[model samples]
Target: MKKTVCAIIIAAFSVCVWLQNAGAEDIKIGSILRLSQGASDGLPARRGVEIAVKEINAKGGIGGRKVEVIFEDSKDTDQAAVAAFQKLVSMDGVKVVIGPMKSSEVLAVAPIAMREKIVVITPNGTSPKISEAGEYVYRGCSRIDKQAEALTQFAKDPMKATGVAILYSNEPYGKGCNDLFTKQFTALGIPVVAVESFMVGDRDFSAQITKLKQSTFDLLFIPGYLQETAPAIAQARKMGIVAESMGVYGDMAPKYIELAGKAAEGHINASEYDEDYATGKNKKFKDAYYSIVKADANEPNNIMFAALTYDAMGLVAEAIAAKGNSPDGIRSYLDSVKDFDGVTGKLSFDANGDVVKQGVYIFKVQDGKYVKVK
Candidate 1:
């Protein structure tokens, strides 16, 4: 009887040890993204993180520990983003987080992330204000100012745009683009003849287009998410306001072309990733992304968001592997990182935690496809 009781106690101790070891084998990270509102961009961003995690785990993960990501829906609002960040940090105990993709959402959660000392990297936030958000906040994409500079230069030089008109979405991202691009255009000796704004879900752009038509402008620049931008461009073209249309990075998506149809022809925009970029790493990532997107017919196909988030996840993993899995450790690696090759480009971080990548690519829609013009 004594021997049996002793054996039972030893087995229970061993079981408890195994359970603890099993729990410790996984390194938990978190992601807050637009899973419901603005899902066209958000879904692809989520897939990018997932693909990177899968690849990392397949290669034995960071420091031989498996990686697990806890994802939360931001619902494309500031309040939802704050709640998501709180849940991820306080409840899930993740030291690193990879989203809240919009500039508004990123700014919303920046304070909490800084307070908690957690590493937060946004894959697509582009507001100039984000530069001052906090030391713990990082962005994987170029700022709107950078895009405006490159695009306005292209407009002045190649397009020969002497006068410009603006149609912008009345949101943080779109409004920021309008303000920056307007300044850039003015600096380049091109005058902005007219400016118009539309709400997020506004479909009938006839009124704005009519206002723009009254102005004698050689270039029409529309900056916003594709959901509104595409339809606005289609409506503008229908209203006969054809004067060399251009857009910011938000216009780079298959859905944009699909929505604009014939109106998308000759439309120009700045882009982060080039689908035809010749690299083994890019090819593998592109193939994996397409395979997954093709399997789900409902999935929105946009490689830009996915590519950015994939690189963000890759950088985070590299940081954890090089240093430890702490927020400070990750920030240290990012700050000193130079020429970290990503599918998007050779990436580094500036003093402001914004990605210093090879300059944005200029693409134009021709024959129902986006062809890199510069």
Candidate 2:
């Protein structure tokens, strides 16, 4: 009887260990981001995923299976992004991926993602082409056109700019923004007086600024990432161009202020996330974010990129919890559950996998901080 009891106890303990090990099997997700070339944006985005994973794991993970994210550095190139994405799917066996932050990179990897049936959620790829990428691809932020609508409306009513000049980065994102914003501004009865283009790494904007200064425009909109836009604005201002500097969501970082200095003052831009949004969810996210950021001295505490990726990760985790860890399961869950209460706001995905939020928040740089204007 004593031997039989010991045997039974051992058998039960083995079963418990097996069950615990099974529960610990992680549901892996992939993140492909511009970690080296565009680390400013990518780092904040990574932090957002880390925070969401930390929270989800702390709360018993997704359906008792611990969530794990495999990160791959895209280095801000199409080839690098495609390679990273392929590795994530083929080697890491991830059914879902978080990014390839730029539209060009997303466009490059989107075909492969469709072929592999891997669900990809781009947190910041705002190019209008992403709407047609496929059902498997989704975006966390609003479309470029939506941002243009908000920014243009603000230009008409508040800024009262009659003529606008565009200095855009000679790339897909910047060119797309220039085209869309120009159309929106025209619709709002504002004429685009001057247009100039600059390469990605071009630090000297003297030529563009000189030409733009010669033109008569009320507002100068630089449609590019902060890396270029901030410096361009600073150079333009230094060359005595007084057009109120404005930009797209890419300029919504504090780094822009740090780069542009006094030129950033009164600089207007559109943002998908409002840090001051009064909600329990927002407060919780802010607190958790600050706690993590405070610990990591190198982390940029910017809320825009973090908020976008946080919502994306939350959506993925929710889908996994509701359904299994299959791509189709995630896609189906996303389709059915339109309204997700995100830190950004109420997020609803349209048929094209585009998030439908209330509206973009119009912000202006005042005293080296983003102040909400609309």
Candidate 3:
């Protein structure tokens, strides 16, 4: 009878311990990314978040709670993004989300995020409209206007181009860049000779290039994602259109050089993150990222997308650790924090939840590598 009593007491004590541990359960975070359709950019962005989460968990996690990320594929479409985001909010009960890499997708989910009072931070959606999306929406990348500013400056002093032509994607992001960069370039005294656009998945640029070739321009600015931009530039070069090629942040990837091949040489673009910044954290991140990428040959890796998303994940982890898992808690902490060191740069969110780093690095592709030009 005494032995039985002791056994019961031990069982009860074990249950109490288990209940306590369960109370301090893992903190869940949601991520909706373009895992399939736009995997080139999305895969690197996801890897950034994965690295941050892995490092955070290794260091005892957030506030003693193991951080868990629930990932959903956005499929790079508006309908898919909305569904993925709704699933995260409804089924996972996630208060914070990082994803929907495209501006259109982010815009599609913005209303729902605002209504649900969830925090949504996009690492690569650079539409200026996103600045006014909602209080619940934040962006880890510079707006299209900011990227245009850097590229325009480069156009004036370095390229010394008197006239430029634009070949942009027809989507929201591409259209925004075309408009903003044109304004910035014209403001800098560079006249826009021609403007042409192609659909998102357009593999043939023969028609677009024919029109662009007719325009007498010294510089060719293609401000779309690398997938289309690279091929377009390659076709333009093959057609003997020798206008110097330039682009925005999306063109900074090594894949751009690989896709454009010899045409990628002398290509100019702006980047938010400098891979050779010489910062200790950046060095560590690059080393870890290269190690991870080495293990998986199929996954695409790029500095701009990875660094931005890495900083986004770090920001989320900081906010969660400082405040809690609540949306308001994360926002409150994010608003007040400053000079948070990240692989991208010293990141601080402004009132609109836009990353406050004002500087953009000018990069040129030389010998199939991104060399910092300014």
Candidate 4:
């Protein structure tokens, strides 16, 4: 009876100690992301954050505090993103927030984040609208204009396209990309024949295809992530209303190609990060990425947005550690951040919370794989 009582007393003491330790220092970072539950682009976005958090925790953590991520699904909706951001800041009390795979979602979250004085970083929300979203908004990756500008610089030859059509998902992200693509193509002397918008969730492209079939656009600028774009392409290809010169990118995923099948072969997808961009840092990431995810994957596995998203979280942690983990100090440190050497390459943000780096490589699948064309 005495021994059993002693054991009970020790167990009770252990529980109390564990509870004390658990409450000591748990730093919560809000992850306002579309994730897998939101959109097809989210699969890799989540993977990137998971990978970085694991690596960061293994490296002694942020200032000896245990880091915790609070994931709130925004579902790629404006209202949902605004609500998620409120919940993260007002309820969960995350010191720093990262992500929302889509730009439209990022825009909704940014104003709230600015009001709360929290640091909100995007892996890749390149819509020019995000630059002035708020004081707290930061982008680890480059924006659409740069990517589009890069595409226009390198792929104008392919546009051998005398006339092209601009089809976009009637959303901010799609509209943003098409506006630039149309301007660039027109600058190259390619006339834009058809500029149409489709509802975000619409799957049937028959209506759009019928219109295109009757037109003479040699190319098309179909933008937006795969959920809508993929099915639209499949339907267009099925109708033999294919563009002589066509491509899509900015929201590249394996499913885009997989869902598009034979039609996806010659389709050029632009990317912000080229696996072969530079040396050491670039190569190491690629080798590790392929070994684990396998080389046969169909998606844009090496998406810089995802890698940069992971890096964005780590940047917040590092900044927090440097500034005593206080929100204000971290925000100040963030402003001072210049040319941060990240997994994607050198990251330098401008006054409006935009990165200075420019260029998005146009990639194509040669044999069921994405190969950098330039």
C-alpha RMSD values across all candidates: 2.3, 4.2, 3.3, 4.2
**Cα lDDT of all candidates, in order?**
0.92, 0.90, 0.89, 0.72
TM-score (all chains, Cα) for each model? 0.95, 0.92, 0.92, 0.83
lDDT of 1 by residue, 1-374 (tens): 99999999999999999998876568989999889988888899999999999999999988888899999999978999999899999888899999988888899899998889999999988888899999999999988888888999999989999899999999877887888888889998999999999998889899899888888998899998888999999999898877999998889998999999999999999999998889899999999999999998999899999999999999999999999999999999999999997989999999999999889999999999999999
Between candidates 2 and 3, which one is better according to TM-score? 3
On residues 299-374, what C-alpha lDDT tens digit does candidate 3 reach at each position?
7878577888889989999999999899999999888889899888888888898989747889998888999988
Backbone clashes in model 3, listed as residue pairs? none
Worst 10 residues of 3 by lDDT: 299-308
So what's the TM-score on candidate 4?
0.83
Compute the lDDT for candidate 3: 0.89
Alpha-carbon error at 24 in model 4, in Å?
5.8
Looking at model 1, report the run of 10 residues with the lowest lDDT sum: 19-28
